[model samples]
Target: MTLRHAAFAAAAAMLLMGPAHAAELEKLWEIDGLKQPESALYDASGGVIFVSEVVGDMRAKDGDGQISKVSPEGKVVQSGWVKGLNAPKGLGLSGGKLYAADIDELVEIDVASGKVTARHKVEGAVFLNDIVTDGAGRVYVSDSGTNTISVLESGEVKPWLRNDRLNSPNGLAIEGDAMVVASFGKPAAAGQEAVPGFLVEAPLSGDSVRTLGDGSPIGALDGLVVLGGGKYLATDYIKGGLLRIDQSGSFETLAPLPSGTADLSYDPQTKTAFVPQNKEGKLTAFRIP
Candidate 1:
């Protein structure tokens, strides 16, 4: 065969096999009737999922916010498992407590009794968006409005990192000694500009910031999940999509959804992911491989 023919055949073979074997997300289930569900947490041991329902305007302090309990099979076990919150967003589980990021406080809930345990007010915080807990029991909460990260240690909330380079930090996760953050990009007025979001990494014990994924914007990122081994999954809130970013900062789209993918939860053992479609008012699960 001619060299050109052989090359063409090889290219065709790759095209045929690429998508068939590429990473994909299989829809497992979806739970509807949620009022602006914004975050999901998969509790493997309890076999339940906790979803944050931001009922009214995101910025309003309307005491109508709550958390809902759902089964792994996408059933709303209790629509209002915990109530009386104010614009709750991100959620993290540690020390037998569930820490939720409210507008300006880190609200802690007793996981066993579904009761409010403590509300640690972050001084001068605005739009607290995401929460994470490290192995040392240090709780980190991100403030998107102020572009700062606050820490809860020894019952005190203090600023951990404050840098303009954060660019509206939204979602956060702890990977080893580094803190992974999904930025909402530079803030802009409506119709003034279209600023794409990105990701960054900071040392847990230091104050340096490093951009991720080829230094290119990823489009209004929200929920971030570390998929182990220098890989991560981040949801695009504006585009309503999911992406897999490798250690080297290269990314690929796993799914393109409606424009409301908020905070995400994943189970490593099952390779299952739970995403709350905020505007759609639904909680969807997908099996990622």
Candidate 2:
């Protein structure tokens, strides 16, 4: 079946398997006119939001991608805070710098000056999607194209793990000594079709990757955030919704969203979620109660 038909089937299946309790999302505000906004990062210290826009093709190196600065009150502070990127997706903040996964490179920007301080290329990387940073200032990037996870430390980038079992990892989140990965599932092959992904845990110090729970397929997970108490909030890129997942691998759909919802950012203090609607060219803020 085509991707569109698959999406519809997924949505219908979700409705059939009703959630135990559907969490209501109060729409706080929305900022429109964005260009394929793929990821959002909440800067608590700066009291603002950073959005990465893939203005052109997702894999093109046309240098039209950029990061925009938005205010907490839903105002566009800077349309092109940091420009000249190549299909930038995920956004991470560490050591007073903003890191963006630009295709095969990690573009670093000084938070204060909004200047491109460095661009660390990932050798042989296909599509670098999501990024996360640990408390120790280590940045981890997930490459969806290569089913690999790479790390940046001491001003260098290197492949940390390359596991086929990762199922084309898309989002990365550091949880204590392990990194929780949101896989995009395997790519569509000649005789096989694409399937829904699941969550996995990879120890930071070892190569052993453990699949959470029974490894039941969730949707094509994109953005992932720790909701504390062994729970997580993830966005389903294919099914088009937000999911609340437990450590045991069971999950419930929280909210149905637009089809192209990409990476999600949450503000824990305010209990607000920022979702980037890539095809809609908008960033929506919702209060999760």
Candidate 3:
């Protein structure tokens, strides 16, 4: 049965370590009306949250996709659907514009117009995953297929950086001039479902695209968000837990999510972390202290 309303999906209280706040993390809403919820972000104006539904099937990846908005009152609604998309993931909203990363492309939705305003086909994007936007209007996208990250310049694809040190870079965030990345150190491919996660840092400079070799410790890092005061929260898919990383490169587990947490983002103004469960088709909301 479809849940009439979305509620908190919380597990048992956890014994946190290393000065971490143990505020209860709960499942805010379960997306029944969609298929394969992969990534989530907030709509600043309407007090709603948008989640990407990636349709993957038995023999092939269906790739027909959509975005659902959950209102402040815990109601789920279909906000927009992108045509010719292949599995949308990693989402961001800036200046009232919503940008999403699908399996092979990037889509921009004009919330005011309620139409697909722009679409960029990522060149050689095997798994276009997470995206982050600098408030100044610069957008960064992660392409896990080629172990690379790209940026959109004037609506055209530009090679940001490609490094073999990073593999399956799924989630992205911007901290000052540094590009914070969370990824599993393996190429995201069929038949290899077992790989631990890695959280690494790289300066945003395209020429100096070198891994810092130091970042938040994670397990199959899937999604990531940056919080106020230089802290990070990530979805660890391999260990099935949420990880908290501090500025000093120190980290610990916050809470254990279900088997399939695909993406996450934070609203610094509200201090709330938005989490998406891809396989279970659920969305979780957490208050990180």
Candidate 3 — which pairs collide? 8-27, 9-26, 9-27, 197-220
Backbone-clash count (model 3): 4
Over the stretch 1-289, how does candidate 3's per-residue lDDT look in tens digits? 2343322222122322234645665545444545777887776666777777777741134646777777643567655445445677888776667888876677888877657788888888777888898867777899877888988867778779888666678788887888888876653468765556566778878555445346433577888888757678888765567788766667777777777777876677767777777767667676776
TM-score of each: 0.91, 0.90, 0.81
lDDT of each: 0.89, 0.91, 0.72
- Candidate 3 or 1, higher TM-score: 1
lDDT per residue as tens, model 1, 21-116: 565569999888899999999988889999999999898889999999999888889988999998989998888899999999899999999999
Off by over 4 Å in 3: 1-33, 57-63, 79-84, 187-195, 209-217
Q: Top lDDT: which candidate number? A: 2
User: For candidate 2, lDDT tens digit of each residue in 1-289?
Assistant: 9999999999999999997664677889999999999999999999999999999899999999999999988999999988889899999999999999999999999999999999999999999999999888888999999888999999999999999889889878888888999988865689998788999999998487889778999989999998788988888887688788999999987678878888999999898889998988989898876
lDDT score, candidate 3: 0.72
Location of the lowest summed lDDT over 10 successive residues in candidate 2: 18-27
Please identify model 1 stretches exceeding 4 Å from their true place. Answer: 1-20
Task: Predict model 1's lDDT versus the native.
Answer: 0.89
Q: Model 3: which ten-residue window has the lowest total lDDT? A: 6-15
**lDDT at 137 for candidate 3?**
78
Which scores better on TM-score, 2 or 3? 2
